[model samples]
Target chain A: MSLIIKDLYARVKDGAEILKGVNLNIPKGEVHAIMGPNGSGKSTLSKVLCGHPDYEVTGGSAEMDGQDLFSLSVDERSRAGLFLAFQYPVEVPGVSNANFMRAALQARLPKEEELDAVAFYKNLRARMKQLGMDPKFTARAVNEGFSGGEKKRNDVLQMMMLDPTYAILDETDSGLDVDALRIVSEGVNAMRAPYRSFLVITHYKRLLDYIRPDVVHVLYNGRIVKTAGYDLVDYIEEHGFDFVKEEHP
Target chain B: MDTPAFNDADELSGKLRLALEQAEAEARLREAETPDRLNEDWRFGRPHIYAKALVSALESDTDNAGRITIQAPAACVEPMADDMRDGEMRLRSIGSDKILALHLKRFGKGICLCIDTVLADPIIITYETEGVFTPSTIILAAEGAAARIIERHIVRGSGLLVATRDIKAMAGADISLELEVSGESTSGSDQPRAMNITNIAAMDAQVRQLTRYSGLDWAREETVAEILHENTTIELFSANRLHGTQILDQHTRQIHSWGKSTSNLLYKNVVDGSATATFAGNIYVAPGAHETDAYQANRNMLLSEDATINSLPGLEILADKVRCSHGSASAPMDEEQLFYLLSRGIPRHDAQMLVADGFLADAVTQFRGSESDGNNTKI
Candidate 1:
């Protein structure tokens, strides 16, 4: 009952290598944090896991509940209960936020099951209010002209609506103000369940302060070079990453 | 067979006579840019269209019989004939447009609609053609009159269609003209229209023209209009969808000769299969035409890689302090937008259609706004 990855090696399609022999595991009930500096491939790991088309997995094995993850297509991976909160959510013009969400949820149902419009809207309104979002936001074209904080909140909004089994958030805290950080963190915290696990990827320690992952790992040069408890954040903040690199190298 | 049925020397007066003579002389000498002859091969995709005069129902209805007068050439006699002759001459001097010449010569009869007062109901005109056909219509909304007219053309079969529409709005008149052109070739009806439109306005008049062409095998649509007086407004919107081996070529010009007037032209095209679309729009602000506000935009979305679109957005500005914006673009659907929808589990086809719908949604929504009037018209 976990998302287990081992010997993960990936590179940009016909370009430079990004992820090099990485390994990570998050059991069903635990949350893990991966922090690294720019060019260390923290975001690349998240995209590689979600089957982004630009990345090529040279050598790796990832599985959820003993099911082969690499065998599924991008959409298939998503339908099989895998979710990634993109750092920069794409703005889809002509598709309303509400309509986009409805389509996403509708795709999860069986072919014979009809989606209930009344229940869908009723549930959507409740979830939106919980995230402190205006009901009018549902009508706005998906992500187009959205403020930075609003787009991040929208990401969490979708995350809450999707309810995937194993969710990975890449830099979900970047570009957010203090107030927006609290709202997004609260949304994630509300979704924390014993059966659902999270791999939260961020460059800063502030996001960890909100989500409070049980395990912290330092990703350097595309590898998980160090692993520790939550207190490792205080050490890295007080001392910095140069010592960790020196000690690990 | 050579003599056109509308050719009655005593009945045809003014520019109509001169134009028919010119067309006949040109025919005798050679085919001089006739309506049947296309200016150029459609660069995107070409469809073989035959032009022939067809005999079918020319459906028409008008409101308030006392306030409206519908006439054909013979029904228009001496005194009113003089007035109609003046309009004919003006239409001729406007341009050397061959479609107008075809309307002057080949089209045997046309409806002359005149509304003298604000109408309680709207006017509806429907023209459906089988085989080769030609039709002409004239609309005149007299001074201080407010009226709406809807014109539809449904063409079928292997035939060429030569058509013309002329609209005159008097001072303080508010007129709306909506034209819909569609075709069904397999059903033996072809709506391939080689059409020309002339919209003339007087002081403080407001004219709204919306043209929509769908499923046309071959179409040549051209509209020319002038903001001739102060405080007049002209709004033009056109949307077209062509599929299979279809082609539509369009040219439009909106001139603000008088100061303190506004003209907006927006056209959108959705091309799929091996279809092609060509759109050229020109907005000119003449000198002394100060405070002229003109906006023109053309956007084309090619649904298939084989589909093609060419757009030319021209602006000739000679006035100071004129607010003008002109842009033209042709692009395939955004793959990133598609993948985003696909990532959410939408099927490939529905996802593509949704994005295409969004691409034309802005123009379509604005068009609906212009058409969002009380349409009591029943046909």
Candidate 2:
């Protein structure tokens, strides 16, 4: 089983098309990394998967685990095990991080089940200590006034807490330092399992060195132009998108 | 006309009777016409809209030893006739507003709060009332005395409430005064209510004032203060939330009478449903009051298209070498922030509240000592 997108086409509400005729399949239990240049629709693909209201899907379809993903709302898509870690996480100024996480976890539970405050805090503090995050952040507003590195780590913390079956990290390593990168990678690796999958979208090859994607794809011009193993990373590091364009053309 | 300040009054003390008679005569002789759309300040506040309602006095506690909390060293606790105090409430709250005159002619007994030592814990005065409740208080902080006083009122039912609090801080006194008012619909249609607050600061005194008003139906609150001495500082914050057919009119004034003094005011409003909220903040710096710093701001958010908010920030500065600034903003919720929360699997209504909590975060943070309570509040 896999998340399959066939000929996906999307555009801004009134602007020019951003995603045009894209095809990709991320099979369960396999980690895939998509690297691309600027304006390659990497962020758009992630947003569309979560049903962002600003973008409209003009044609084609996407399905996850044999269920039509397009039929669900943004929140439903999340409860259906699809997750997108934002590149620029928005600040919810008054909501505490603890409360936000609690609401998110509560949303995932059955309707009659109430969230246990004690267990929730116990698990939250444990994960926070593991991520090297100060416990004070648990009471602070969600990503409000956080530094660039802090925001990225917060994104990873969210991903870890939710534990979605299929997760996409949209440029999660762009603004991170070397130390932050290693810490974030460890957080991701701790969540890696046979039943769960990850689609890592980044611009640099350095992030792949830590997460170690099993399959690598070159997403060029809103389409997966070439697919290979880790060797494609070496080729890109040497010749860049120039050779990918030559091969696809 | 609209609701009468009072329908009729029972027997009163001879002194209070004389003051009421004189105030009634003066109010009638110089009766200002109902400020309709013609007056600039009354553009959003149509004082002509009147509804008839009953009025009565709220029973007072005979022994208030339990009510008056002196967290600091004890000084004096006394109650007096306070006859002329009610008559002055009219001009003290807002010179142009005539509604307070009607209140003075009816009810007139209040409490005087005085502290002589620095307080480690906040002094809380809590009250619950029904019917037409008229409660008044005066706070006095002696020199070098530091204290935090909170007056909280929770009221229910359809009746008018006339409240007045006069505060004074002497030299070197650090004082904080907080007024938290909440009203609920208990029975019938909720009637209009009026509140008046005034504060004065002496030389070298630092005073911070906060007022949190939430209403169902209709409420009118007037908060005003003046820096009377040199080298003093004052800060004022207001937060309001209204729903249903509530109509709220808030008037605030900051006056700097001496140079080398600073006064700041910030007001935030959130109106939902078919409610209407109005805010008017005025800052005045007297001539020759050099080096005076005055600032005022009003921010409003409407939860629905039908809701309305009117904000006016006024500044009158005649002194040179003075710094003054004022701003007012009225807008809806930020859609981008809303989308971000919804994508996290939060329900639609919960997401709306979260964004609202964020919009009012700045004002919430200013509530001193509230953060240490360990309660998760998205205020």
Number of the top DockQ candidate: 2
Please identify model 2 stretches exceeding 4 Å from their true place: A247-249, B1-35, B50-77, B83-91, B191-194, B197-202, B369-379
The residue pairs in collision within model 2 are B2-B50
Kindly report, for each predicted structure in the order presented, the TM-score of its chain A compared with the true chain A.
Answer: 0.97, 0.97
How close to the true structure is residue B287 of candidate 1, measured as C-alpha lDDT?
95
Residue-level lDDT of model 1, residues B228-316, one tens digit each, is 89888888887777788787777778888898999888898888998878887788889999999999999888888899888888899
lDDT of 2 by residue, B232-282 (tens): 888888777777778887888888888899887878888889899888888
**C-alpha RMSD over true interface residues, each candidate:** 1.6, 1.4
- After superposing candidate 1 on the true structure, give the runs of residues whose Cα lies further than 4 Å from its correct spot: A111-113, B1-32, B35-96, B104-163, B172-180, B183-203, B240-242, B318-321, B368-379
The TM-score values for the models, in the order shown, are: 0.80, 0.88
Best prediction by TM-score: 2
